[model samples]
Target: MTNIHAPEVLISEVGPRDGLQSVKATMPTADKLRWIDALAAAGLREIEVASFVPAQLLPQMADAAQVVQHALRHTGVRVMALVPNLRGAQAALQAGAQKLTLPVSASPAHSMANVRKTPEAMVEEVKAVLRLRDEMAPGVPVEVGMSTAFGCTLQGLVPEDDVLRLAVLLAEAGVDEIGLSDTTGMGNPAQVSRLFKRMFQEIGPLTGAAHLHNTRGLGLANGLAAYEAGVRTFDSSLGGLGGCPYAPGASGNVVTEDLVVMFEAMGVSTGVDLHKLMAARAPLKAGLPGEPLYGMTPEAGLPKGWV
Candidate 1:
């Protein structure tokens, strides 16, 4: 068995894809590659490099194939990409992505608005991706992320049973792992603990992670809650760069720097260098000028004489 207390947690950076997609200005592909390389050098082993969505829908991801191809050349980094459906999966697989994440929203309204498919319909799509992975890229894991798993801006107070049901459905659909996302930043620490505990109890032994938003400023706390509930992998964007367009001003994913600092400070190793990780942000800032970068640790600075 993989030890639950494996010393440090795995923080998967989603800044390149999640962060860049939310902005109006698109970052150059070369700059994106440089940023990914820098993050890899900083000891970040997993990164959601880009999404394989159509260029017309998300121009920011126009060069996702190129980015994925480049990221594959890096050793020791698990390259992940988001695919809305089978077509994106094929593109990602052709580009050599080692892992693929498919989003299935728990909120009906959010689901329809985002992917134009209901949760159950999305599960069917997940099944299709799984089949394709088996036939084409055998052994490549397909992950189903339950967005709005905590709460939703469109359909508020998403039921726990609903989220768990979809997770079970995805597992039955043959996905390798399942993840819970607070896409609209509606999650709190107590809610996180309750939901994750129930999830593990009902769906024990399945790999799970927390993809939280700091919209309400409880991202790190929620992460700790899920971690205590046995979640080892965390999905965060460097500098907290994503947010729902429906909910203006709500920060998107949790900041990787803050998440890493929280764990490492508690004597839990993340295998990520704080200074080196922080340095990797320069390219991100340069790529998208005038965009606000969010984080507390980066501003407060590491404590003096503190190792």
Candidate 2:
């Protein structure tokens, strides 16, 4: 397992990247840093702080390097960034990001549309990025969130065998870990559990985080399925800020506040303080005025007399 995952469960906050990218507005760097600070203070250990994409493509993440620099100040936070290719990886590493995530789609239709490459081609890209990682940032870990592993809106009903095969390919390519993503949010709990079990059988401990979206109102349920399937790390957005710009009908990521509350309530020990986590939403609201945020726990507040 990557040293980035600690405690019984590690919540990797992806709001700054996945959450912000899907939104229509570009939040200023100052407010972005404040939102990250609020997340860290709320005890999020790994925060996906930026996506190293071209400014024209994603102006919201135009200051990705600057954001990474700011997030690094938090003592215990493992600051992460997303990279689309070798160039993005270089930029993220140069910015001192402690961990990196790359999306490798299991569906060919999704792959070509999202990254302009096929599945096999992306593996080669992963190799290229690994070579660069070895050359530039030897110890920094690289993760691949294989998007559309469960299903795809463009292609429909991805084969579980294909997902497993690509995961094995990624593990053999020497990535630190490989995570499954319900990119289009079409996954059911049963499919989630079954596929993750097979992934474990194939890649062993190299299996990584679960990146489930709440598009069908199954994000938390899918997350529970992953945990029961032996996944310990999860990617979520604060206040459910996420959706794929490339995937039609893709929606918000599993909300960090709600996921933490679910796990903590089940005695799973996510290590996040619920009160502080709820308070962290303030910066998000402040950063992008009038942007709708989602979290049932935050909206309802903690239960009465239930510390």
Candidate 3:
């Protein structure tokens, strides 16, 4: 929502952070840099490049600072990193991340399992991160990706009232922007539209991206629904590459290349070069050999005369 009137939608690629963290193998630093450069060259304006978690917990993200440093060299792209707590946020800030995102799960069961904290406690952690951001990196935005915002695997059918309540708490807590995530990919189009409409009603312009997953094959459907409900930013991974290790049955995010095709073909400009974006998979595959990459567009190829 940086430029509300801009015709193009913002596709924030999260492959490096979300995708790599989900897999068993760690991508080498050099290959990660090359892959990021390829993505930037394809005209992705924003990317969640890394997560600042402990190396022991997620070794794939052990080189968080190094990746941030490399991604910063790309002039126009907004380099973002995920921070789990104030400590991670401090590391990200010191590493020169332009934007920081913290995941605050709405389901208490998911929250305790993932971060070992209650929903309310996670809010306090968010407040602490905000305070630290204000002290260390004053204008840099701190976004909260409300995980399991739609539903949870552990605690099924997360109440809508609970989701809205957390949104209000996050808004009042002073997060720069609050984005809803289908962390478990349990969201449907109608549910997505309804929740997003409620979110905008409650927080107005503070509502951010649609971080939907394709686990149920409704990622694009839910994304379109959110767009109709006024969400301009979308979070996707390069090869539909991410899932929460803590959230059972969670799998790939909405694919970036397919998303661009859907929006661009519908006359909604995404500002991403379709061919170049597709080519980014080269480095991805090179970096993580034998890892399966998913995307219908790549498998089926762009339709004849697709602009």
Q: In candidate 1, which residue ranges exceed 4 Å CA deviation?
A: 1-7, 244-250
Q: Listing every candidate in turn, what is its Cα RMSD in Å to the true structure after a full C-alpha superposition?
A: 2.6, 3.1, 2.7
Point out the worst 10-residue segment of candidate 1 by lDDT.
1-10
Tell me the tens digit of each residue's lDDT in model 3 across 48-90. Answer: 9999999999999999999999999999899999999999999
Can you write out model 2's per-residue Cα lDDT over 277-298, one digit (the tens) per residue?
8888898999999887888888
Distance from true location, Cα of 4 in model 3, Å: 16
> Candidate 1's residue-wise lDDT over 1-307, tens digit each?
1123544688999999888888888998888999999999998889999999999999999999999999988898999999999999999999999999998999999999999999999999998899899999997888878899999878889999999888888888888889899988888988899988988887786757799999888999999999998899999988888765665663778999999988887877888888899999898888887777888888999877655
The most accurate candidate by lDDT is: 3
lDDT of 1: 0.88
lDDT of 3 at 92: 99
TM, every model: 0.96, 0.96, 0.96
Worst 10 residues of 3 by lDDT: 1-10
In model 3, pairs of residues that clash are none
Summed backbone clashes in each candidate are 1, 1, 0
